[model samples]
Target: MTTGIGQEREKNMEYDLGAEVAEWMLSQTGAPDGARSTTTLMGLQWDVFPGVWHPNPGTRLFTSWLPIADGCRLLEVGCAAGVTCVVAARGGCTRVVGVDIYPAATDNTRRNAARHGVAGRVEALTSDLFAELDEDDVFDVICSNPPLVKAPESRRIDTATEQMVYDPGYELHRRFFREVGPHLADDGRIYMLTSETLADPAELRKLAAEAGFTGRVHASEAIGIPAPVMGSTPAVVAAADEHGVVRVDFTMLEFQRG
Candidate 1:
């Protein structure tokens, strides 16, 4: 559902300009191309130059933690456009399941998997988190770049591309940590990406600990905004400061389950 906002995010860029710019960059052609030229992760070549949101830096950063053992079952939460799924499959994962709330995103992901010649190894489904997933199912690895924006009550939906800006707050993140454990194999691990805007290393650690899982911060990067002038708003700045240090766009966070 459209959360009282206009049909297009551009109309309200003044409210969340950084998110707007991020959306715009994803629409561009350069981002994805850049990803392709950069590095090969999990045997998949990414297109990051044209942008388009595939191979999101956060997702790529988290992929490093994925064990490359062949025949491993991997699940990608919020798989947008399926690029990460392709990477996992190419990396020799026996099975890869991509779950998202947006049907179009899942469709795109499916198509992309076919294009990469890994459709047989990758499956994309439209579901809200683990709702549609079988509780007994287990995975060797899990990865996600969840919605971590802190916006007003006006923005909240299940679209994969839409900016959450808020809604899936810190509590939801904690819930994710708690719920993921049961779906993991004995030696399974999780790789999650978040920003300082939602929560910090300490917060995620606390959540994992409470869930009876050992966790560690694998990597972190300062949230860098390419066009701060276009997307920086007072609300965004203030919301970012609430968690940790506020920067331009987002502070990339990687959480590993041990």
Candidate 2:
């Protein structure tokens, strides 16, 4: 289903639309490609590059559940290559904005939106979470496919090449919740994606709660961890094995600011 869904994600897990995730039962099988130089999703071709997050299963699941509204303002957090943002704009959002810490992501998002014929409705910016975001630019809907992997410190991390999937102490996600509050409209909703490898559903809910928001599992899939993915970060695997976690649950979370 996806070669490399997210830039920080190195696991070659794949997901098909409309498939019952339970049926897989943590099956680790081969996917199309790990590099994912080019791919197609939701009937659109994408030019994905290294260091940019690809549209993984969590992404597809979240986007499929997007509460599309007429002329609604939409925001996509951490839009790596602008795949989901482009989809939202093409689907008829009045205006769509994408934000990412990586300059490549913003550049690609803008270029892809234009390529997809939605440039007028799409704008992308390079920002660390909400730092560069304008105060008055509240969005009716927000989506995130954040990096959730708990990468071992020794694992190679190159901002120009690879994003750290390891949250260390889940700090990145925690910061997202803490900083995302002000940018959300009064009646806005957020659809976010993450994996069990980093945090469980209950833990995710608690994190959101601490940040003055309520989050729940909206869509989920059980992914089997293969040898290659496990080997990429033996330290993380060892940690998970210590906790008896052999399977990763890919989840989509829906929450909102009150």
Candidate 3:
């Protein structure tokens, strides 16, 4: 079922909408290419890497709804800028592990952890999902604000930046559910961030069910973002905001092994 945005995002389904939004956001901030920079989010300063996904509204919403507890072990997959990892560490998690496919992203997490004085509680690893994690490494809390936009392989740009936006057939989402059970403590909880503007919640539920997990919407909110409009190129830029903005429905899905 859809909320907030309704059918607005479906208007530009043929275009690479995820990349368009990212480009518009980057252009608005004038972030230099291939350079490291710092920005503050969730009231904490974060060191952002060139190709890493910067924390956005969805990221913030997920963190706000995250179920972290003191002394619990936490794991954040696709921890681009390590925002969630640092947040968990500061929240009193005994150990917070942040994993990403990009080495630069892992380094960026380390930098942010150090900058925030949580280095002692955080470990940054370069990994694709749980590949590098030990089979016995389990956590009380496992969370990921993964790439939600659904696009075909042919349409994907395949950069680290784009990887943060497009899931390309929901392969990553499928893998996440299929692989997560073994790494979660019996009482562990899993949280995933998704949006109606970018994905089909029903399909996600099917994937989760296939992997033996029961899921529910833990939290949801409506957020406005730049609308996509027909242009010379397929990209819907931030400039389109002058025309109007579209409301995107963001949701945090809670899952437990069935």
Off by over 4 Å in 3: 1-33, 153-156, 226-243
RMSD of each: 9.4, 9.9, 4.6
lDDT: the better of candidates 1 and 2: 2
Tens-place lDDT digits, model 1, residues 1-258: 665555465334434544554454434323322443333445655333223345555555556545556888988887866777887788899989999776756776787788789999999898878878898879988777765553444555544334422334465566677678777888777776655433345666677777777765566665444344334455445434434333533333334455
- Model 2, 76-166: lDDT tens per residue? 8888788888888888899899999888678878878888899899999999888888888889998887656544456455433335344
Cα lDDT for residue 228, candidate 2: 41
- Candidate 1 has an lDDT of 0.62
What Cα-based lDDT does every candidate model obtain? 0.62, 0.68, 0.78
Please provide, for model 3 over 1-258, each residue's C-alpha lDDT reduced to its tens digit, 9 standing for 90 to 100.
865475555555424554465455444322326677788788877778777777777778888789778899999998888888888898889989999998878998999899989999999999999999998999998998887776675665635556666677889999999899889999888998877766667889899999998999999997776464333243444323464664557888888888
lDDT of 3: 0.78
- Alpha-carbon deviation at 226 in model 2, angstroms: 7.3
Task: Specify the highest-lDDT model's number.
Answer: 3
Q: What local lDDT does model 1 show for residue 244?
A: 35
In model 2, where do residues sit more than 4 Å from their true spots?
Answer: 1-36, 151-164, 223-248
Clashing residue pairs in candidate 2 (N, C-alpha, C atoms within 3 angstroms): 5-54, 5-56, 6-53, 6-54, 7-53, 151-166
* Ranking of all predicted structures according to TM-score, beginning with the best and ending with the worst: 3, 2, 1
